[model samples]
Target: MARPKNQEQRRQALIAAALDSAGSKGLRSLSLADVAKRAGLTRGAVLYYYEDLDALLVEAHKAGIQRFCDRRDTLVQSLDSPGDQLAAAIRAGLPSGPDDALMRLLYEFDVLAGQSAVHDELVEAMYTRQLAIYTSVLEAGTASGDFAPVLDIETLAMNLVALEDAYGLHIVAGNSHITVDKAEQAMRAASTGLGAPPTPDGGETPPA
Candidate 1:
């Protein structure tokens, strides 16, 4: 029906607004009014789409994760080499910089994970999904003899995800020296240590 379509559209708008507000102000300070203002809608209208701030945040966090996953998928889709795929995944996983709204939102949810069951579940699911991406890449690389025979794929994946989380938080927290390029370089070095092929050009591949 027309009403359902309108509702869905409004819902998406609110989510987009929430992401924008979170990007600028950080999720810790995000409010219904901020989201409503960003969406050019009233608070009541936002409430009509989402039950409350927490509900809206949960959905927004999921949307952010989906966006990141889609980007990584697109970046590696045409790459044939597993080493290249792993490198692309690393670059795609990190935020552009501290100004990255989606990454900011992700960390915001991470800080709140233990506060409630919903938050904990969402955080766990997001982490699991991220780890899965790395695991797949590592396994594929090993299978194709592009990567060393990694005895523990899960541990390697966890390490990469953890490194990404730490680096992303530092960048978002205004570590001006810790640029995205530096983060990617560090990740590439770590990947090489894990038995990936070393790039002669310092792992600088075409932009994903």
Candidate 2:
């Protein structure tokens, strides 16, 4: 049991190292050696856990999706009001800040796939999940009479996901102008403009 638990911990460590490395190395140039060095483990040790670099990358991409998308979906579902759900979704979706390596890696995955169709597929999967979060939340808002969407819900959902991705890219790129707070505020404004304003109580700070 101890050995298996240790292995799972090491695998998570490698995934984290890969995300951090991608922020510096970029996905196109990320290599097994970089992840090994970042994790403070030998190449052979990494190999012991993953079949190869691609295997490790696939796992890393999965972790990114879980953190960025799955967690946001859970957060949205926990809220009872559509306004609060949308607000929390907006809050949870952006980068924590300029040094948010996970969000940075997620943006890079889309831009730096190079020749790896695997990377492309992973990025697509993340987008689908991202879009779905907004879709479900907005639909609930409409159903609950919280939103009178100006645009179709599908388009609105796509736009919200696009806004999240664009703002997140800028934030992780260290755009001094696009702070997380500013991004969230802008998104909330956009949501209201698009006809999904959170109610008076829903605009509060989301759970960390």
Candidate 3:
């Protein structure tokens, strides 16, 4: 007999299916039945996990954020210097593979957020959380002397966050035109723009 799926597995399956369906088409067009069909489960099963479309969407957005955060944490773990950690985290924020789809979902949220006051507040909170995460790393680097003392860490952090957001938009416009390698190079240059010198080994990559 086949093994029955666990609750966590089902949740993950639903999240994946929802993202897949919503990412390709705008969330405005997404329906529970669409996600159910994509996930290979009945609508009743989907509704059992998510009471309604709004509930499912909120859960999907949270899952996407959590997934991105997990990836960011894994990439920055056990790093010696704060500068390296900040650079690594910047790279982590970029849309990669499935992460691209998640980001597309975020863009959808941004649209919906414009229409509803509640969503606007939620998006603002999410934005602040992201800025705090990036800025904290920069402040740590400054404190440790890994980055120059004169650097404006807060301004730079915010700029990097904005840059990454724009870069994702460019990629979504046409993946063929934008490459992560180029984005990394641009980020490295931007990092150095704030009076922080590039690592000793060549000028492009931040020292590992």
Candidate 4:
């Protein structure tokens, strides 16, 4: 048995193992044995930490959300300009590639939404958090006179989140149709044309 002091570490390790295992096998097909194999522990050892695979995955999903949204928001807040914040937020929200297990699991969570009430809540919470990022940035830019958005702040924020989710889906799905750079460029372009061009360095000022 893991000592009380190591319980949190053990749980975090299992969460990582579960994400890795499910990354390849997928959420619907994942099993406790799969996680155990990835973690090099017995199924019983895994059960010691989690009631079941679903319980473990619920925590894994929350961890993934925390890492994704929290890091992005923190980075956004670190930047002084709303343009820099918006640009940084968009870039931070994407997958590294098809092999990005974390992003893959996030999409899987969407598929699992109907399987349980907890999943439904996580999915909705993720969407809300994503929307809030853009909304907050856009509102700040508008208030500071940094952005002269073409659309209402709410509409613009919704469109940006939609683009990120859509492009991120394709990027993780391994579509040759779009690469990360293309997605980022397209999103930044959409942002610029929509009235919120990132004005830090690479961003163009919106049309007069």
Best by TM-score: 4
Candidate 1 residue-wise lDDT, 1-208, digit = tens: 3398888888888888988898888877779999999999899888877899989988898898888877787776667777777877887788887777788778887889779998898888888878988888888888888789444788888989999888888887779888888988898778777776534343345455
For model 3, how does the per-residue alpha-carbon lDDT over 50-127 read when each residue is reduced to its tens digit? 898777777777777667776776666656667567667767777763347777788668777877676776677667
* Alpha carbon lDDT at 139, candidate 3: 74
- lDDT (CA) for every model shown? 0.81, 0.85, 0.73, 0.88
Off by over 4 Å in 4: 200-208
Ranking by TM-score: 4, 1, 2, 3
- Writing each residue's lDDT as its tens digit, candidate 4 over 103-207 gives 988998899888899999999999999999999999999999989998899889889889999999999999998898899989988998888988644333345
Off by over 4 Å in 3: 1-9, 97-99, 149-151, 175-177, 197-208
Q: Top lDDT: which candidate number? A: 4
The list of candidate 2 runs beyond 4 A from truth reads: 1-10, 23-30, 200-202, 205-208
lDDT of 2 by residue, 15-68 (tens): 999888887888878889999999998998889999898798788888988887
Q: Please give the range of 10 consecutive residues that has the lowest summed lDDT in model 1.
A: 197-206
Poorest lDDT segment (10 consecutive residues) of candidate 4: 199-208
TM-score of model 1 (CA atoms): 0.90
